[model samples]
Target: MSGQTMYEKIWRSHEIVDLGDGFSLLHVDRHMLHDGSGPVLARLKERGRSVSQPDLCFATLDHVVSTAPGRPVTSDNRRRTIASLRDGVAEAGIRFFDIGRTGQGIVHVIGPELGISLPGTVVVCADSHTCTHGGMGAMGFGIGSTEAEHVLATQTIVQAKLRTMRVTFVGNAGDGVTAKDLILAAVGQLGSAGGNGYAVEYAGRAIQTLEVEARLTLCNLSIELGAKVGMVAPDEKTFDYLAGRQFSPKNELWNRALASWRDLPSDHDAIFDAEIEVDISHLKPKITWGTSPAHVMDIDGIVPDPSSTGHRNAVQYMDVVPGRPLVGLKVDWVFIGSCTNSRISDLRIAANIVGGRKVADHVSAWIVPGSENVKRQAESEGLDRIFKESGFEWREPGCSLCLAANGEAVPPGARAVSTSNRNFVGRQGPGARTHLASPAVAAASAIRGVISDFRTMKD
Candidate 1:
C-alpha cells in the first residue's frame, strides 16, 4: 500500500466517486450556517425548495449582532437576516441556536466546543474558518454562498481533490511560545501560498502536546497558507476535550466513538505529496509587521526592510519603516476573541495576564467570547471579573472584533494587537492596522499600552 498523509486517508475514506477533471463528489456529514448565510436558504425556499438533509445542518447567529451587554439587535437589515434564518430553520426542521440561546457562539467555535465536529466527519460552512474543525481529525472547508445553497439541497458538495502536504513540528516550544507563534513562524518560513492546492496534515511531538483549543487555533489559520484544510491526527487530547460536551455521545456510545477515533490516525509510512518540518524550540511570541499573515517576526525582532524584498506594496500598506522593532509600538486597541482564540482556556490565559492590572489609559480593549457557553464558563470562574476590573469590556459572545461587523471596529489609523486569525489591512475596519497575536499577548499589550510580552508579567 502507498503511504498517505492523514488528510489523504480521511479524504479517501469519504470519497463518493471521481467526477473527472480532478474533481470528486464527496459526502458531507455536518453543515453549519450563520445568520449572514441563512437568508440565502430562505431565498431558495421562495423558489419552492427545502433543505436536503435537515438533520445534518445547523444554524446560529454570530456575525452582524452586537455583543455588548443588553444591546438588542436593532439594525433593520440584521433583523431581517436573522428573521429569515429563524424562518428557514423552522421550515427545514433544522436545529437553530438563536441569539441568547445556550450553545450559541461563532460558527466555528460552537461546532467544536459542542462536540458536533467529530473525527472523520466531513464538515462545511459558509465561513472560511470551517477548517477549524479539522483539528478534530475531520475533513472540513468553507464554501461560497451559492455552493452553500447546493449543500442545503443535497448533502454533498462537488470539489477538486487536493494534493496533500505534511507539516511536522519537532521539539518542544520554549517558554512563552504558543501555537499561534509556531504557526506564524511557519507562515513566515513557507510564505503565504506555500500550501496552495493541498490539504495539510500537521504532525510531530510539538503539535501533539497542544490542547485541543490550541490545536484549533493552528488549524484555523491553514487557509491563510492557501491550504484547503489542515488537520491533526486524533488522539487522547481530542477525545478528552469532547468527552463531556453536550452533543457528544455518552456512556457506551462514548466508548464506541473513542474506539473509532483511535483508529483514525494515518498508518506508518503513509506517503505525502510534499513535506516540510519546523523546529518549535526556536519559536517565540510573534507579531505581524506587514498587512499579511506572512509578514511576521518574533516579538523581540524588528520589522523587515521593504527594500530587502520585492513585496513593497505590503510594506507600504502597513506603514512601517524597515528595521524598526515592533515592541513599544503604540497601539490604540487590544481585541481578544475570535474563532481562533475565544475558547475558555484562552479567556483564562488572558485574564491571568491582566487579573490585577489595568489597561493603559490610552488603550481600549474588548473581550468577546466565541460563544455564550464560553462566556458563562468564564463568568463562573470569575474570569470576566478579572477583565472588567482591569478596564476591559467583557462583551457577549460572537465574532466581535474579529470582523468589523455589528459596528465593532477599530478606527482608521488605529493600531490593534488582536487574537483574531488574520492581519490583513482593513480586515477589522477600513484603513485599520491589525497585528495578530495570542490572547496572552493581547492582554499584555493592553496592560502596557504597547506591544508587550506576557511572559514578563506574572499573575
Candidate 2:
C-alpha cells in the first residue's frame, strides 16, 4: 500500500467518529475567534450549550475594528460585536487577547505567532485564511458561523474527507520572486478553481527552503485558489519557529512535540490524487491584472485583451487599456498590511526598500503590522521610523485596507498596489481597483507612484 499524505495522517488522528460516505466527526484542538465571531458565541449560548473546552479557545479583535492609533471602538454595531465576544469568552473562561494586549492582532497572524497552531492538530476559525496555521503543519481550515457554533458546543465538527493534491515547486525562485509571487504564478497556471474540493500540500525544494512566515503567506491564499485546506509538512524550521512561543509546548513537552513533528511529513512513497509542478526557476514578481488572483501577469508583461470574455468586466472596471502594460500606471494608494503579509519580516522587507526613499507625493501609503507584538518589535528595530521618514504612515494593526472593513477604504476609481491576498471587485472598497503584489513590490510602487517593478529599483 502507498504511504499516507500529511493531510491524511492528521485527519486520521483527529477523527472522533466515522459518519460514513467520506464524512467524519473530527476533534478540534484549537479554536480562534475574531470580532465577527461574536455571532457564533451568541448562537452557541442560544442553543443552551456551554463552550465544551474553553481552555482550548482564544478570541481577539481584527475584522471591522479600526486600525487607527488610539482607535475608539465606536459605533453601536462594532461596540456590540466586540463586547459580545469579549464578554462571552470571559464568561466561558476562554483566553481573550483584548485591545492593548500583547497578543492582539489579526486572527491568522496571531495564531501562528502565539503557537496556538501546531503540527498534527486540527485548528478551525470562522475566517477563510485560518489555513494560514497550516504553515506549521496543522490541519487547519475555515468554518462557517454554524460550524463554529458546533465546534464550540462540542469541541468537534462534522467534515467531509478531502482529496489530496501535491503542488511541487520545481527549482529555486528567481531574485525578486517572493512566496506571494510563487503562489500567484501557480494561480495563473492552475486557474482559480483548480484546487476545488482538494486539500493541497505544497512540497519540493522551494517549499522545503521557505521559512514559516513565507509558508503562512503561501497557505493564506489557498482559499483564493479554491482549496479548502493547504499545508506544508513540518520540519526543523517549524519546530524552531514554534519553540518559546507563548502557547507552544515547553521543556519535556517541547522535546516530545518536536519528535512528533518530525514524523508529520509525507513518506517518500506517498501518493496524491493529483500532482502539479510549477517551474519557478525563472519567475518574476507578479501582479493581478483583473478581479481574480488567476488574472496575474509578470512585472514586465502586457495586459490581456479586454475583449476576452473572462477579462472584459474586470478590464472595464479597472479602466485599463488592453494590450498595454501596468508599469508607470499611476497608483493612488499603497497598502502594506494584511494577514497575508503584515508580519515583522514582511515589514523589514518593505522598510529595506522604502528606506532613504520618499513615497510619491500623490500616493497615500500605509504600513500596518500584523499584531501588537509585531508592531512593538518593528518599533524596537526602528522600522516604524524608517517608514515614517519615507512618508509612509506607520499605523496600528488590524485587517486594514486589505478588506477595507475597519472604516478604511480606497477611494472609488482609485488604483492601489496592495499586499493583500484578494483583488476581487469591491474586496477593498466600492469600485476600488486593486493590484495584488508582494511587500517589496508594494514598497517600490509607493515610491514610483505606479505599478513599477521592485527589481528595477536599486537600494
Candidate 3:
C-alpha cells in the first residue's frame, strides 16, 4: 500500500469533490473572520446572500483595533468597521468576540486557544497569518477577501492542492535559542521563497519538543518562508493543549475526537515532494539585520556585507555598517508583541529578563498581549506588573505597533528591536529601522538601549 502524508490525508478526507485540473471543492471546517473580512461580508450582503453555514464562522476584532489599555476604538473609521462586523455577524448568526470580551484577541491567537482550530480539520482566515493555527495540527492557511466571500456564501472553497515538503530539525537548540531563532535561521539558510508553492511540515526531535505555544510561533512564520500552509503533526502535547478548552469537545466527544486525531499523523514511509534537513546543535539566538526576514544573522555576529543585489540597499536603509556586530548598536525603541510572540509563555520569558530591571531611559518599550485572554492570564500571574515595573508599557491586547495600522508606530528614523515578525521598511512607521528578535532579546535590549544578547545578561 502507498503511504499517505498528513497533508494528503487531511485533503482527501475534507475534499467534497474533485474539480479537475488540480482544483477541488474543499470543506472548510472553521471560517475565521476579522476586521479585514468586513468588506467581504459587506459585498455578500450587497448580493442578497446569507452565509451558507454561519455556525462554522467565527468573527473577532484584531487587525485595526487599538491595543491600548481599556480597549478603545480610537477612530470613527474603526468604529464603523466594528459596527459593520457586528451587523454582518448578527445577520449571519455567527459568533462574534468583540473587544474587551472574554474571547477577543488576534484572530489567529484566539482560534486555537478557544479550540475552534482543532486537529485533523481545515481552518481558514482572511489574514495572511492565518497559518498560525497550523500549530494545532490543522490544515490551516490564508485566503483573499474574494475567497472570504466565497466561504461565507458556501462553506467550501475551490483551491489547487500544493506540493508537500518535509523540513526536519535535528539536534537540540542551546539555551536562550527559541523557536523564533530557529525559524529565523531556517529563513536565513533557505532564503525567503524556499518553501513557495508547498505545504511544509516541520518534524524531528526539535519540533517534537516544542510546547504548543512555541509550535504556533514556528508555524506562524511559515508564510514568511513563502508557504501559506505550515503544520506540525498533533501528538499528546496537541491534545493536552486542546483538552477542556471552552470550545473543545467535552466528555465522550473528547475521546472520540482524540481517537480520530491520533490517526492523522503521516505514515512512517510517507513520501514528500521535497525534503530539507537543518541541524540546530550550534544554533544561536538570531535577529534580522535587513529589510527581509532572509537577511538575518546571529545576535552576536557581525552584519553581512552588502555584496548581494538587495543587501546594499538594505544596509544603507538600516544605516548600519556591514561588518559591525549587531550587539551594542544603539536602539531607540522596543516592542514585544504581535501574533508571532505575545502568548503567556512569551510574556514570562521577557518578564524573567526584566523582572527587577528598568527599561533604558533612552528607549521606549511596549508589551501588547496577543489576546484579551492572554492579557488576563498575564495579569493574574503578575507578568504585567513585572513589565510595567520594568518601565515597559503594559498595554492591552491587539496587533499594536506591529504594523502601525492603529496609529501606534515607532518613531521615524528610530531603531527598534521587536519581538514581532517582519523588518520591512516602514512596517512599524515611516523610515523606522525595525530589527526582529525574540521576546527575551527585545526585553533585554529595551533595558540596554541597544541590540543585545539576552543570554549574556547577569542574573
Candidate 4:
C-alpha cells in the first residue's frame, strides 16, 4: 500500500460511497447534539423518522443554558429550548446530559471527556467547534442544522474531501507560552484565510510536547483559519488520555482499540498539498489587538499601524491608537472559559497564576469551566478556591460570554481580555473591545488590570 496521511486514512475508512466532484457519502461514527439541535430534531420528527443510530448519538445542554449557580434559567425561551432538546433526545433514545447531570458541558469538551471521541473515529456536531475533537486524532468537523437532521435520519453525512496542509511548530515553547499563544502567532503569520480549502494537521516539536488539553486549544482555532477540519495524529499520549474514560473500550477491546489507534499517524512519506512552518523558540504570549484573530500582537508589543481597511476599522472600533503598546492599557473585564481553553488543565494554569493574588479591583473576572465534570474536578482540586479567593467569579459550566448570546456580555465600549477563541466586534457585547489571550495571560491580566504577559510576573 502507498504511504497514507492520517486524514487520508480516516477519510477513506468512513467513506460509504465515492461521490463525484470530490465529495463522498461518509458514515458518521458519532454525532453530538446540543440545545442548538432542537430544530434539527424537530425536522426529523416532522419526517416521521427516529434517529437511525441513536446509540451513536449524544446530546448535552450547554449553549443557551444559564451558567449562574443555583439560579434557574432566566429566559423562558431558553428554558423551552432546553426542554425541547430533552424531549426530542429522550424520544429518540439518544443519551442526553442535562444541566447538573453527568457529562453535561460544552459539546466539544464533553465528547472527549466522555470518551465518545476517539482516535480515528469520525465525529460531527452541529457546532463549528466540533473540530476541537481533532485534538484526539479523530476525523471531526461541523455541519449545518439541515445536515444535522440528515445525520440523525441516516447516520451519515455527504462531505467533500479537502486538500491537506501540514503546519509545523518548530523549536521549543518558553515558560508561560501556551498552545493559545502558538495558534495566535500562527494566525498572525498566516492571516484569517490562510488555511482556506485545506484540512490542516499540526505537527513537530511543540505540538508533540503539548498535553491533550493544550492540543485541543490549538485545534479549536482551526476554524479561525478557514479550515473545516484540523487534526493531530494519535500517539501514546492520546491513547493514555482515553484509556479509562467512561465510554472507552475495556479489557481486550481496549488493547484492540489502541492497536488500531497506533496506526493512525501519517506516514513519513505521506504528501500534503501545502506546508507551513512556524518557529516558537522566541515566541511570546500573544493577544488579539483587533477583531480578527489574525490581528494578534505580542502581549508586550505595541498596536500596529493600520495596514489595511480591516486594520483601520479594527483600530477605530477598539479605540486603540496605532504604534502604542497594549501593556498597561486598562481593561474592564476578564473571562477564562470557552471550548478553546476551559479544560481542567487550563483552569490549573490560571489558578497557579492567580493564587495569592487578587484580581485588580478595577477589573471584573469570571472563571467558567467547559463542563460539569471540569467544574467538579476543579473544585475537588481547590482550584475554585484559588480563583474565588483571588476575586474571580467561579461560574457554572456553559459557553458564557464567549458569543455573548446568552445574556452574559461585556459592557458596550468596554475593554476586556478573554480566553475565548474569537475577538470579533460585539462578540462579547456591543462595542466590547475583546483582546483574546490564553488562560494564564487572562489570569495575570485579571490581577494586573491590564493585558500583561504571564511570564514577566514576579514570584
Candidate 5:
C-alpha cells in the first residue's frame, strides 16, 4: 500500500467520486446541527425533502438557550430555534439533544466528548469550530446554512481537496504553557492566512503529550490559520478519553474500536505538502495583540508597534500605539467559556485562579458554560461559587460573549480578554476589542483588570 497522510487516508475513504469544479461529493458520517442552523433544516422539510440519513444527523439546542441553571428558556430567537429543532427532529427522525438533555452542550464539545467523533469519520457541523473534532483524528469542517440544508437532505456535501500542512512541535511545553499557547504561537508565526488551502496535521513530542482536550484546543484554532481542517493522529490518549463516554462503544466493541483508532496514525514516511516546526519549551502563555489570532504576543510581552509589523490596516483599526506595553492595559470586560475552553477541566483551572480573588473594581466578568452538562459538572464542584464570589457573573450556558447572539455583548470600545476563538475587529461587536487566551489567563485578567499570568497564582 502507498503511504499517505492522515488527511489523505480519511478523505479518500469518504470520497463519493468527483463532481468537477474542483469539488467532489463526499459522504458525511456525522452531521451536527444547532439552534442557529436547525431552522434551516426545518425549512428544508417544509419543501418536502426528508433527511436522507436520520441516523447520521444530530441536533442540539445551545447557541441561544438560557444557560442559567434552572431558568426557563427565554429570548424569542432562542424559543423559535428550539421549537424548530423539536419539529425538525420529529419530522426528520434525527437524534436530538435538547437543553436539559443528558447529552446537551456546545455541539462541537458534545461530539468528541461523547465519542461520536471517531477516527476516519467525516463530520460536519453548522459551526466553524467543527474542526475541534479533528483532535480525535476525524475529518471535520464547518458548513454554511444552505450547505447545512443539503447535508440534512442527502447526508453528503461537496468539498475541494486540500493540500496538507504538517506542523511539528518538538521539546516539552514549559510550565504554564498549554496546547492553546502552542497553537497561538504557531498562528503568530505563520500569520492568519498561513495555512490557506490546506489541512494541518500536528505532530512531535509536545503534541503527543497533550490530553484530548488540549489537542482539541489546538485543532480548534486551525481555522484561524486558514486551514480547512486540522487533526492530530489518534493514539492511546485518544482511546482513553473516549473509553466511557455516552456514545462510545463498550465491551468487545470497545476493544475493536480501540484497535481501529490505534491504526489511524500516518505511516512513518508519510509526505505532506508543506511543513513547519515549533519548539514548545520557548512558548509562553499568549495574548492577542490585535484583532486577529495572528496578532499575539507572550502574556508578559509589550503590545506590538504596528509600524514595525506590516498589517497597517489592523493596527490602525485596533488603535494600538507602536511598542506600548500590553501588561497593565486596562480592559472593560473579561469573558470565560466558549466551545474553545468551556469544558469541566477548563472551569476547574479557571476556578483555581479566581478562588479567593476579586475582580478589579472597574472590570466586569462573565463566565458562561459551554453546555448544560458543563454547567452541572462545574456547579457540583463549587466552581460556580468561586466565580460568583470573585465578582464574576455565572450565567447560563450558551455561545454568550463568544458570538453576541443572545444580546450578551461587549459595547463598542470595550477591551476584553476572552477564552473564545477569533479576535477579528468587530467579531465581538463593532469596535469591541477582544484578546483571546486560555481560561486561566482570562480569569486572571479579570482579577487584575489587565492581561496577567496565571502561573503566579497558587492552586
Candidate 6:
C-alpha cells in the first residue's frame, strides 16, 4: 500500500477485526468514564455485563459534580449519580478519581493532564470533546452511552471508517489570537458541519508551533466542526510536554514510545480525501455572535445581516441588530473554563490580562480550572489570587457552567462571553445568550462588561 496517514496507522494497528460493511472492531487503549457513566454502568449491570480489563478503565466525577470551593455533590440527583459511579467502579475494579482527588476533573481535561492519553493510542470517553486527546497524536473520539458500554464490556468498539480531511491553518497567529480563535475561525469558514463524515488532521506552520496544551485546545473543538476525530502530528514539543508526566511511559519504555510517536505523523507522500487551508495571518480573535459557532466575526466586525446569514432566529435570540459591531456589546456574565480552554496555559494567559483590572460591577465573572491538578498548579502560581483580587471568582474545577447541569448557569436572557466550546441556545442555561471566545477575550469582556478585545487592554 502507499504511504498512510497517522489516523490510518493508529486505526489499522488497533483494529482486531474487519467486520464487513465498512465497519471494524477496534481495541481500546484507554477508556474514561465520568458522572454520566453512572447510568450506563447501571444498565450494563442490569444486562449482567461486567467491565473487561478494568485496569484500562478510569472513572471520575465531573458533569454532575459542583465546582464550588467546597466541591459539594450539591443535590440529591447528583448525590445518587456520584454514589452510583463511586460504587460501580469499585465493584468492577476500575480506578476512580473521586472528588478532591489528584486526577479529579473533566474526563477530557484530566486525560491529557495525567498522561493517560498518550500519543498513538486509542482513547474513548462518553464526552464529545474526548477528541481533545488527539493533541497527543492519538486517535480519540467520543462514543455514545451504548458504545461506551460496549467498550466497558468487550474493550472493543465497532466503528465505520471515516473519510480523512486535513485542515492546514497557514501563517502565524499574532498576539491575542489563540488556538481557540484559530479553531473558531475554521468553524466560521467551513461552517459547523464542515468536517462531517471525516477525521481531521490539523497541520501547517501554525499547528506545528503550538505548545502541547494549545494543541489540545485546537483539537478540543474538532467535534464542533463535525469531525469524528482531530489530531496534530507529534513532535518535540509534544514529547517534551509528555516526558515525566504521571502516566507516561518510564525510562526505557519512554525511549521506545518516543520512537513510535515520532513515526505517527502522516507520511509526506500520504494523501487525504479533502484538503483545506486557512490563512490566520490576518485573522483577529474570533467570537460567536449567533446560536451556532459558525456565526462568528472578529471583534471589530459588525454583525452580518440575519437574512443574508440565515441566522435570523439566532440574531433575535441574541438581541443583536445586523449592523452593530461586536465590540462593546453588553455582557452580564463571563466564564473561563471548559474542556477546551481550561488548561494551565489558558489560565495564565487570562490571569496575565486580568492581573490588576477588576471585573465590571455588572458582570459576574468566574474562572474555573479544568482539573484538580490544574487548580493546584494555578494556586501555586498565584493565579487564583490574581483572579480573586480582581473581583473574579476563582472556583473549583469541574464542568461547571460549561454544561450547566450542576445548577450553575447564566441567568435567562443574559449575555455571556464564555471560553467554553459551544454557544448553542440553552447551552449555558435556558434562554441564555452566549458568545463564545478565547479566555483572553473572556477576561477582557469581564473587565469591560462588554465584548471587548484583549489586544486593546494594556496591563
Clash counts per candidate, in order, are 4, 0, 0, 0, 5, 0
Using all chains and alpha carbons, the TM-scores for the candidates as numbered come to: 0.97, 0.98, 0.98, 0.98, 0.94, 0.98
TM-score of 5: 0.94
Residue 89 CA error for candidate 5 (Å)?
1.6
Candidate 4 global TM-score: 0.98
- Local lDDT at 145 for model 6: 98
Better model by TM-score, 1 or 4? 4
**Which pairs clash inside model 5?**
67-396, 67-397, 68-396, 291-423, 305-322
Error of 4 at 318 (Å): 0.9
Residue 214: error of model 4 in Å? 0.7
Model 4 local distance difference test score: 0.91
Badly placed stretches (over 4 Å) of model 6 are 308-310
Local accuracy of candidate 6 as per-residue lDDT tens digits, 1-459: 678999999999999999999899999999999989988888999999899889999999888788888876668998998898998898899999988889998888999888899999999999899899999999999999999999999999999999999999988877778899999999999989999999999999989888999999999999999996999999999888888988899999999999988899999999999999999989998888899988899977899987654598899989988898989989999999999999999999999999988999999999989999999999999999999999999888889888799989989999999999989989999999999999989999999898998888775
Please estimate how well model 5 matches the true structure, expressed as its whole-model Cα lDDT.
Answer: 0.84
Model 5, residue 303: distance off in Å is: 2.0
- What overall lDDT goes with each candidate model? 0.87, 0.91, 0.91, 0.91, 0.84, 0.91
User: On a 0 to 100 scale, what is the lDDT of residue 223 in model 1?
Assistant: 88
Could you tell me the C-alpha RMSD of candidate 2 in Å?
1.0
lDDT by residue (192-224, candidate 4, tens digit) is 999888898999988998999889999999988
- Please tell me which model should have the higher TM-score, number 1 or number 5: 1
